[model samples]
Target: MTPARFAGVLSAAVTLGVAAACSDGGSPVDPGGCAADLTTGIAAYDLDGLDVHAVLPTSTSSCIVANADSHFVAVDPSAQPSGRLFVFLPGSAARARNYRKIAFAAARAGYPAIVLTYVNDLPVGVRCAFGTGDCYEEVRREIITGVDASSRLTVGPDDAIEGRLVHLLTAMESLDPGSGWSTFHDGASPRWDRISVAGHSQGGGHSLFLSRETTVFRATAYSSAGDLEPLSATPVPWLDGSWATPAERIGGFISEDDEVVSPSGAIAAWTRIGLDDFGGPVSVDDTAAPWAGARMLTTRAPPRNAGAVFTPHHGVTVVDGLTPLELDGAPTFGPVWAALSFPGS
Candidate 1:
């Protein structure tokens, strides 16, 4: 876009407030080796035929209050569009760049993908540990919609997760109009029905809640669904709250030996959400693609970093650092990701 035209869009964004702070023109990056993509517990994904970019959101815009980092965008140069956008969110305090492998896999599966940067400094469970079940749901509502429904965090409409997504998608439309990002946008809001949502850990919880709030194309959680209620065998009972996505339209993946959230609690949450209607949680290690048509999927696969002292069970499913590697350097859990979010590919 011309500089003057870009300025006009920025002006419009500022006027809109909540939708402000979309990205500047995205900058191409070497996917195989971005320094920040790899850290103490994060991994960098190598590119196959995908173009990876780091697009900085405008700090002047309202949508970037709690955090002002770049969002990661991935696209396969040679794949046919799948008529779907794969949206990935990172865990608490995790950087967006750390999720390139998951996003790259999505791109290869024919869906353009993005790893968003948002206000994830405060984990939901940590902030709402002592409250009732509604506290968990309402905190998430505040985070995603800026509804001020909870007191855990002060997220405004502009700094809410939805606002950040709207901003980034708007950025893609303005800076890369020919890239087809507009297909996921309807008017000023995201066409959530055409978007598939998934994430790791805390992001996974957010994914579940967002799916609950809207009829997303699909909802998949990796290594998380919801936090367990303290001193209880279940997650905070909020699935029965106002809902949109059905249990059948949702899928989840996790390491069977996760150390963060109790496996039984996760299973309890899934069962209560009605995932048992599709089928019980199936192990990906013994089963293949369809996984017996199950919506709740689990794996006993050991982490690659198991020998490095102790494995971080929570990172085994999708994080680059702990997830095992295949012979070709692709993520060991690559196929599982596609399975969890299939039909979008």
Candidate 2:
């Protein structure tokens, strides 16, 4: 169920309820249903007073955080928060800073957002040289062993990623008590029930995994990668004839021209999860068009730095110049911001 389809279904449900009420001779139902308008322009939320902070992890137990190799970018609202927390994870070899645009958009909408960078055990040069298959396995092993051996927290035996994430969330909760971290962590009578998580490439895969691992996150948006093995292994239903997450809670974006992660794989994953076809790909030249209603925005390779080895298509989701319609032409947010901000609206 794509977000568009989910919206349609929700609208239908509301209509049916209204009809039932009318038939019962009750008061007329209010015409206004859900507050979100999928086709409407992105909201022009104010970003003034939003503070951006860089935090270096001091916990030696978290190998990914305390190793001096990993850090995070946090965007917090100046006033009391709305209790909405958005977590962004970067792709392999990419740092948190790359996704600052998305975080800035989330902050503008009154949600405190964090862009988290994991240990880049495999640098870009090494990854490009060895290829994704070998480097992926090596990075996976490093995360597993690193967290199991060094982490003080324990989500589960096979949940090293979740464990490290827990540590980070704990640290962030302490950093800003008013930022709603306590609501996320307090098991008993937690002030908040769930959060929003988004990522790109490898980070996207991690976001998907976290969705299944914890019910703490109410929504997830991811791009560039759709390795469904982890989701399949978990009890969460996705394309395997089991119940799946509500479409409104799961948002995805992928470039048809992406050379790194196959667009077909992403489509297959989306199909299995039951998303309606939003539309054909947006041309690279159509970067200025509004992307509020687009589920998949086809784009050409983004311009790369001189002598850069990797292709630009792979980095489309994190490009700094892109913006969602909600930002009203603010070029600071990427296309993925639509999905990240969708559930909040």
Q: By TM-score, who's the top model here?
A: 1
Question: lDDT per residue, candidate 2, 1-345, as tens digits?
Answer: 246534553453333222111111121112121121212211112235555545443231222223333444355555345567777767767777677777776776667776765554443223334243333333443343233322222222112343344444554443433465655544212222356777777667555544443443444434544353332222113233432345435556666667666776666665554544554344434665455454444544443441354555566556443322234645433434644442445
- lDDT, candidate 2, at 62: 21
Q: Residue 25 in model 1: shift from native, Å?
A: 26
lDDT for each residue of candidate 1 in 1-345, tens digit (9 for 90 to 100): 346644554554343333312332122111111111111121113366666656654432433557767778888868888889999988988888878888888888888898888778878888887778788888888877766788777876556677667756765554445568867876446788988888888898888988877899888888886767778757776765656987777888888898887777788777777888988788878877777779888888888767653437888888877888889898977877886774644
Error of 2 at 105 (Å): 1.5
Top candidate when judged by lDDT against the true structure: 1
lDDT assessment of candidate 1: 0.72
Q: How close is candidate 2 to the true structure, as a TM-score?
A: 0.61
TM-score of each: 0.83, 0.61
Poorest stretch of ten by lDDT in candidate 1:
30-39
